[model samples]
Target: MQKLLYLLILIFFSTVAVAQDEDRELLRGTVLYLNSVVTGENVINANTRKATITNNAGQFEMLVKKGDTLVFSAVNYKFKSVVVTQDILDKRRMVVEVKEKVTELDEVVVTPESKERFLELEKEKYKKYDYERDQYTRLQNYATNSGTFYNGINFVNIFNALRGKKKKDQRNNEPLKVSQFLREMYEDEFFVVDLGIPQEDIGKFLFFCDDKIKPADIAGENREFKLLEFLVDQSIAYKKIPKE
Candidate 1:
C-alpha cells in the first residue's frame, strides 16, 4: 500500500507539470547591440514566427512558446539566434546582443609584359630627343644617390649604355640582359617583390631596352637568378620569350 501511494503521488505531479507547461504562453524580445544601439527597426517578422527587431529605443516584443527558437538579423550585423525555455519565458523582456562582420579585399597584381611593353614604346618615342638625356640623367642621379647594393657595376654599365659609350671591354662585360638579371636575382632571393609603381616613376628613368635583352631566353641558366625571378614575378621585368 505504501509503494502504491508513492507511485500515485509521482504520477500526479508529473501530470500537473505537463499541464503547467502546456498553459505557458510564448514571450518575445527585441535584439539589440551590446551598446543598446538600434541598427534597424521591423527587421524581424512572423514567418520567422518567434522573432522581431527592436524599436528606436532598442525594444521589441514577440510571442514565443517553450522550446521555440528566436532569430535576429540586420543588414549591417551578423545574424543571431537563441532558444527560449520555460525559465526565459517567465521574463517580461529579453535583450540579445549582435556583432558585426568584416570583409577584406585581395591584393592586386600588374603584369610584367604590359609594363615592359609600355616602357619599350616610350623609350622608342623618346630615344633621340634631348629630353630623354635629362630623364636618363635624373634616373642615374637617383640610383647614385641611393647607396650601391652591388658595387655600382650594374648601374655603371647601364649608364654607359644610355650615354652611347660602348667601350669594347664594357660591352663584353655588360651585365646579363634585364631578363637574365631578374632570373639571377630571383635565384638568390627566397621571396618576391612588388614593382607595380607607375611607369613614369621607374620606367622612363630606369633601363628601358627591350630588344637588347630578353628574359625568357636567359632563365634557363643554372646560376642564382633570385633577383631576376623576383622582378619578373613582380611584373617589374618580363622575359620576351615565354619560359618552357
Candidate 2:
C-alpha cells in the first residue's frame, strides 16, 4: 500500500509539472539568455522566415508559440536553434550557449617536377593537333622562338629552387602545433579505428585538451613523444564523460 501511494504521488507531481508546462505555452513572449555577449546574433523563425538580431547584451525577446523553431546564427559562432516548448514559453526565458567557430585553412603543397618531364608534358599538351598541318607547325615554331618552350636552368634560379625545396621539406617534416596536431590526429583512422572516438566528438575532445597542452610545448623535436604523453594522461579522463 505504501509503495502504491508513493507511485501515485510521483505520478501526480509529474502530471502537475506537465500541466504547468502546458500553461507556459499560453504565455506571449520569451526572453533568451545569451551565455556570452555575442553581438549581432541573427534569430530567425523557421516557420515565418522572420529574423531578429540579438542586442549587444546578447539577449532577445521573441513572441513565439509552442513548437515554433528559432535559429540563432552569428559570424564567428556556430549556429544553434531551439523549438519553443510549453515549459520554455511559460518560463519566458531561455539560456543559449554558443561556441566560437574555428576555420582551418586548406594546406597547399607545391612540389617541383623534373624539368625534362615538365617540358615533355607541356609539349604533349600542344601535340593534340597534327604537327604536319601548316597551322600547327606555325604555332609550334612561334611558341619555341618566343621562349615559351624554353626550360633552361639558371644557377641562381636553381639555387633558390633548392633552398625553397629544403625549407618546404623541413616545414612538412616539422612537428605541428599541439592543437592542430591534435585536430589532425583526431581525423586519423587510428583514433576512430583503434581508440574508438566518434568523429563528432573530435572537436570537443580537442577543446578539452587546450589547458593541458600548449602549442609551444609540442613544437619541438620530441613532439610525437609529448603528444603521446598528453593523450595517455587525458584519454581516460575524456572517456569518463557521459554521452548524451
Candidate 3:
C-alpha cells in the first residue's frame, strides 16, 4: 500500500509540471499589418495549428508559443513568415511589413516606323548600282579626261580595295552569337523575371549560374526549362541567407 501511494504521488506531480510548462510556452500577441493603405491580412500559426485574418484596421489577436511559425499571406501582398520568439511573446505584439506583389505589365513596343516601310524607304533613299550606266559613264570620263585617267592608279587595285572595305564593314556589323545573346538574357530577363529577384541582387544570384548550362549551350526549345530549373535551385540557396 505504501509503495502504491508513492507511485500515485509521483504521477500527479509529473502531470502538474507538464501542464505548467505548457502554460509557460503559450503566448498571446497581436499581429499588425504595417501597410499604410491596405489592411486585413491572413495570419497562420503552424505550431498552434490555428489561423486568423486581420480586421479592417490591419490588426488581429492570436495565441502562439515559443518556436511557433507564423505565415502572413494575402492576394495583394507578398507572402511572409515569422518564427515566434520569447522576445515577441514578451512584447505581446509584432509589426509585419509585407511588400505588394509586383504585377507585370503587358509588353508594349513603341516604334517610329514599321520594319517593312523602313526597309522600303531605305531602298528608295539609296540607289542600287547600275552596271551598264556606270560603264558608259566611265568610258565617257576616260574619253573626255584622258590625262586624268592615265594619272589614276590601276582599276583592278581600286576594285580590290573597294571589295576589302565592304568586307570589313560587314564584319564590323555581324550579328551577336547565340552564346553572347544568352548572357544578355541571363542578366536582363532570366534572373529578374523568373526568380523574382531584385535588380540589385541579380549579381549575387548570377554567381550560382553554372557555365555548363549557359543559355547558348541550351537548345532553343529547352532554354526556358533549363533556366527555370537553375533559377529554382539558386532561389533555395538565396533564401538560406538572413538578408539579401
Error of 1 at 24 (Å): 6.4
lDDT of each: 0.47, 0.54, 0.53
In Å, residue 36's CA in model 2 sits off its true spot by: 2.6
Model 2 Cα lDDT, one tens digit per residue, 1-244: 9999999999998897566445433322322333336667888878556578877677676656788898888777787888988788668777777776666554322111233333334345444645434231222222222211211212222223334545777547543334444553333443444344566766677777787866656543424344544564465577679988
The regions of model 2 sitting more than 4 angstroms off are 1-35, 105-244
On residues 1-244, what C-alpha lDDT tens digit does candidate 3 reach at each position?
9999999999998897666457644444344433353456788887655678877667777666678788888887788899988888888777777776656654322111233443333234223535224321232222232222211212233333334445677657543233333343343544454455667877665654544354334433323344344446555566467882
- Per-candidate clashes come to 21, 1, 0
Better of 1 and 3 by lDDT: 3
TM-score of model 2 vs. true structure = 0.31
Model 1: per-residue Cα lDDT over 121-212, one tens digit each: 43454345463243223443333343222312234433334334335556465644563333222222122223443433343312443444
- Please estimate how well model 3 matches the true structure, expressed as its whole-model Cα lDDT: 0.53
Candidate closer to the true structure by lDDT (higher is better), 2 or 3: 2
* TM-score of model 1 vs. true structure: 0.30
RMSD of 1: 18.5
